[model samples]
Target: MNTKIDFSHLGDRVVYVKPVAVADLPQEVQAQAEGLDELFAVHNADGVQLALVADRRMAFLLARQHDMSPMTVH
Candidate 1:
């Protein structure tokens, strides 16, 4: 299985989408989870979080809207 991905065209406009447990987040963020067990976090290459969205699809959509390439993190 060749899973090679070329991200050269994206340059620095790349973001990561990963699932986050509500319980692992701060109280303030957890409160905003709306009773959901999980959420998706969008982060930059430097490991800085850019946004916390309600779902994985939304996280990817956000990145694309901003002209960024979104990669899923396990």
Candidate 2:
């Protein structure tokens, strides 16, 4: 599948969504981006792919389906 989303530098962290393509992403990021299709298609809602960074590295990607109330991170 092809997507138009891109990444941008958000101060200290890199944000992916606006100007990056899935094919251009790093291996780890490609995996995260690929999962969005399933998340969006199954839930039929806006999903959030939160990428957490530390020491200039991607620590994790948190996928959350849209809900009435915001989700809590722990």
Candidate 3:
């Protein structure tokens, strides 16, 4: 079963930062997560995941590193 959904309507050249669950992450990452549930995900305007980091600040830092301005998706 295909599990991808589209978000092209949100436009382009933008990044969204949102919280993520450790359980939803990979096993290796979960191991490194150290019982952390405060992870964040940085995604493009199209909803393609870019970076997954350990906090709100890191999410924005990741986006800036990629030459993008991060917006908190609350």
Report, for every candidate in turn, its global Cα lDDT versus the true structure.
Answer: 0.95, 0.33, 0.83
Which candidate leads the pack in TM-score?
Answer: 1
Over the stretch 1-74, how does candidate 2's per-residue lDDT look in tens digits?
88874432222232232223455556786677645421211111243454332211222232222222222222
Order the candidates by TM-score, highest first: 1, 3, 2
Report the CA-based lDDT of candidate 1 relative to the real structure: 0.95
Worst 10-residue stretch by lDDT in candidate 1?
2-11
Model 2 RMSD in angstroms:
14.4
Q: Once superposed on the true structure, which residue ranges of model 1 sit more than 4 Å away at CA?
A: 1-4
Write down the lDDT that model 2 would get: 0.33
lDDT of 1 by residue, 1-74 (tens): 98997888888998999999999999999998999999999999999999999999999999999999999999
Give the per-residue lDDT digits (tens) of candidate 3, residues 27-73.
89999997797799998768998888889998888778877778889
Judge candidate 3 against the unseen true structure and give its global Cα lDDT, from 0 to 1. Answer: 0.83
Task: For each candidate, give its TM-score against the true structure.
Answer: 0.90, 0.24, 0.72
